[model samples]
Target: GAGVSQSPSNKVTEKGKDVELRCDPISGHTALYWYRQSLGQGLEFLIYFQGNSAPDKSGLPSDRFSAERTGGSVSTLTIQRTQQEDSAVYLCASSLARSGETQYFGPGTRLLVL
Candidate 1:
């Protein structure tokens, strides 16, 4: 496919464990983002990286959630000391530019913490 894609379609972990989710955007794209949706809640933005510029991390809820985009293509989302409350479907999106850009989403990666 020519769209965004994610790995570890599903992940199961215990409280206090750590997990890493991955996203691969379309080639040549310069902007990447990470988001998540909890049960019955709306999608929440986590972080975004654009080109060689400093990453835009204002949307991250806490320091525990972090992401990095390498070479303007692949991105990894890491959750440290996972908690049950962190259970959610993680989504990744990518676009060419921030202004007037249309993001393309990848199949979400579901995380379950017990």
Candidate 2:
């Protein structure tokens, strides 16, 4: 009955450091998604997981970004060698069982890289 939730509502990291952001989806949700919203840019799809299917990672900006869903409930987005340009609000969302379903988003995690 709860909405999606993310951890460390805010993060400030130095360049070249690595960070891991966590997401907890609503109970029983089979679809989870991660997105990035930059200062002036629209939501940028990062990745998503649906049931036991393979995750679609085509939206990841580079090899430095990756994510994984464990036990079909929680997920973690890892950014290695973070850069200033990587600063943005990381949003997590979940839907019933598919990508196009109505998504419930979490209060995004604001990440600032110095």
TM-score of each: 0.94, 0.96
Best by TM-score: 2
What lDDT does the true structure give each of the candidates? 0.90, 0.94
For candidate 2, what is the total of clashing residue pairs? 0
Q: Candidate 2: TM-score?
A: 0.96
Per-residue lDDT of model 2, residues 1-114, tens digit only: 778999989999999999999999999889999999997777899998999999999899999999999999999999999999999999999989853679999999999999
User: What are the per-residue Cα lDDT tens digits for candidate 1 across 1-114?
Assistant: 588989999999999998999999988779888988997667988898988899989988778888888777899999999998899999999888859789989998999999
Candidate 1 deviation (Cα RMSD): 1.2
- Judge candidate 2 at residue 105 and give its lDDT: 97
